[model samples]
Target: MNLDHLRVQIDSLDSEIVRLLNERINVVLEIGEEKKKAGAEVYVPSRERAVFDKIRSLNSGPLPDEAAHAIYREIMSAALALETEMKIAYLGPEATFTHQAARNKFGVSVDYIATSTIGEVFDCVQNRSADYGVVPVENSTEGAVTHTFDQFATTPLKICAEAYLPISLTLLSDQPSNEVNLIFSKQEVFGQCRSWLTANMPNVKLSPVESTTKAVKLALETPGAAAIASVMASDMYDVDVLAENIQDMQGNTTRFLIIGQEYSAPTGCDKTSIVFGVKHKVGALYDALSVFKTDNINMTKIESRPSRNKAWEYYFFVDIDGHVEQPEVKRALDELQEHCTLMTILGSYPKAEI
Candidate 1:
């Protein structure tokens, strides 16, 4: 085909694409109205998962699966904005990893509210100040985020969805590498990049701050100071990237939870989380766990935290491999409850694919 002929075809295809997108969004708006009348949630995680799965299956493509997913994410994000004034609260001052995770899941079209602490994120959702909240639950390198766990112990919020963000820490500052005398970042971030710092800037003093974004701000303002943060922070704060991929582990990822009023419905492949306090007796913990084995439910993770109300008493948080609505999972949890002083089903959410 001649160049002019091909150019005409490309322009025609682009026009068709725009028309189809608008048509799809019109249908989405009709569905949103029906949902509002029925008092149904606007953001349904199971439906979201099914849509993405279908998109991947249907794609034959010039575009990769990730690229397609990204495009659809923004499309759905725009639909969501039109359907409702959606607000996402995250643990941040912006450009933090939690903020990045929130944006990754919701895309750029929805509104975001940055709260300083995880507790505030929970509170925002609990009080209806935000439609949903994102909080980091655990990191592959740093273990559990205790603040998030502690909030789950008392809050009525449910985990509606989850996301995994691969963390790539960078050393950001305006100062030249040789002139830098101090480094600042969150304690967890410092831990993640400890080896890199020791090997590259051993003489520089390290200061732990409230958050990496906060550290970036301080770095921008303070003389002879650099901050270990995400590359996004470097751009947002206008600091030069001194070093990249500074985290000790190449596959370092943080798992974040989406908290809302209700848990997600079954998606076949899902995860259920619960917290319980065992009776203070021998074999009590073992008896509680044995219920899962009896019902043949797979438990993925377990972490214990001090109950705080009583000395030496603790509450165990567990993640199991099936939705709470599943027969086997329901039976196992029912039996497990018999061995606990207190038991609460935290939430059942679709497992993050990434």
Candidate 2:
């Protein structure tokens, strides 16, 4: 065929594709409405996974399977958004790392609220002010976010999903001045950029702030001050990016948790989080953990927290291989709970796919 003829045919095919997608989306919207009535969750990672898996299996792609999955994820996201108005709460004054993580998970279509504190984020979810809350849980360089751990122990909300976002720090300041007298960032953030500070700006005073956004705001207001924060913060606060990706380590990352009222079903690949307290006896903790080993399950993470009401008592937080409802997981939990004075299943959530 001639070039003009081919171009016309391609354009016609593109138009047809759009029309078909729109029709499919309309049907998906009706399914979402039915789900709402049946109390089914909108964002089902497992169902989405199944869709991508089927596509990959059938795919003989010049476009590639990953590309196909990417297109489907957005389509699903848009369809879910059409079902209900989702409100997401994140730690913020806006432009915070938590805010970015929330946006990454929910997309820009949902309503996002930036609360001043992590507790506020949790409260938003618990009180039904928000559908979900996103908060930083751990970092690759620094350890756990203590407040997040504390919330898990106290809050009724469950961990619905999790994400690990690479934490990139940027040094931002106003104007073109290089005379940086002070560095502002959160304490843990400072630790991640420790080597960079030691090697480049050792003499500058480091100021620990409540958050990255606050640090960036201070830098914008104060002369000779530079804020070490995510690249998004610099853009939000209108500060010049003095340095990009200034984290000491190349693979610096932070794990964020999604707190919500709903529980997630097993995504085939799932992580179940539980908390239990055992009587302090010889090999008590060892015996409790052995349930997983007996069931041939993997323990992803374990954390110890002091019981608030009782002195000398401790609560153990665990992330295991399978969903809570799975046969093996159910047996393990039942056995483990018998070994403990108190036990709680915090959540059985779909493991972070992205």
Candidate 3:
């Protein structure tokens, strides 16, 4: 074909694509109306997951799944905004890891509110000031965020979805690494980079801050100072990154949860989290866990925390590899309940992609 003919063909394809997109939007509007009539949530996490999964299955593309999903995320975000205004709450003054994870799940087009503390994030959702909340649950290097686990013990909120953010910490500074005398970041970030900091800046001071973004701001204003933070933060703060991937582990990841009023239905592959307290007796916890073994269910994680209301008492949290509504899971919980002082199904959500 001639150059002009090929350009004409491309224009024609673009026109059709635009028309199809409009048609899709109209249909989505209709569905949104129907959902309103039935009083259903406009942002259904299970439905959203199914759409992304279908996109992956249907794509035979030059674009990768991650890239395609990112595009679709914005499209969905726009539709969701039109359907109903969504306000997502996250831990921050802005530019925190939780803020980035909130964007990862909700997309850049949606509204966001940065809360001073994780408790305030939950309070925003609980008070109906925000439609949903996002908070960090666990880090690959540092284990669970105890505050999050503890919050679940009292909060009525449930996890609807999860986002796994691969964390790459960068060394940002106003001065060169050799001459830098002060370092700042969240305690967790410093712990993750302990070895590197010990070996490279042995005599430099390490200070824990409220957030990594705060550390960046401190580094910017203070002389002979540096901050270990996300590369995105470096760009946002206009600080030079002295080094990339400075974390001690190559694949450090943080799991963030999307918490709301209700849990999502099963999406075939699911995970359920629950917290319970075993009765104070010998073999009590052991017999309690055996319920899963008898039911042939896979338990992914188990954690314990002191029940602050009762001295020396503890609560146990567990994550298992199926929805709570599944027959085996249901049966296991039924059996397990007999040995526990209390049991609560935290939430059942789609398993995050590897």
How many angstroms is residue 139 displaced in model 3 relative to the true structure, after the best TM-score fit?
A: 0.7
Model 2 clash pairs? none
lDDT of 2 by residue, 16-96 (tens): 999998999999888888887998877765676577678889888698886886677677667767778878899997888
Q: lDDT per residue, candidate 3, 1-354, as tens digits?
A: 999999999999999988987888889999999999998888888899999999999889888988989989988988888888889999996778888888888888789999988899899999999999999989999999999888999999998888899888889996888889999999999999888888888999999999999999999999999999998898798999898888999889999988999999999899999999988889999999999999999999999999988998999999999998899999999999999999999899999975
Better of 1 and 3 by lDDT: 1
Local distance difference test values of all predictions, in order: 0.94, 0.85, 0.91
Candidate 1's TM-score = 0.99
Once superposed on the true structure, which residue ranges of model 1 sit more than 4 Å away at CA? none
Position 162, candidate 2: lDDT = 86
Better of 2 and 3 by lDDT: 3
lDDT for residue 308 in candidate 1, whole number 0-100? 84
**Residue 114, candidate 1: alpha-carbon lDDT:** 97
lDDT of 2: 0.85
Cα-based RMSD of the predictions, in order? 0.8, 2.3, 1.4
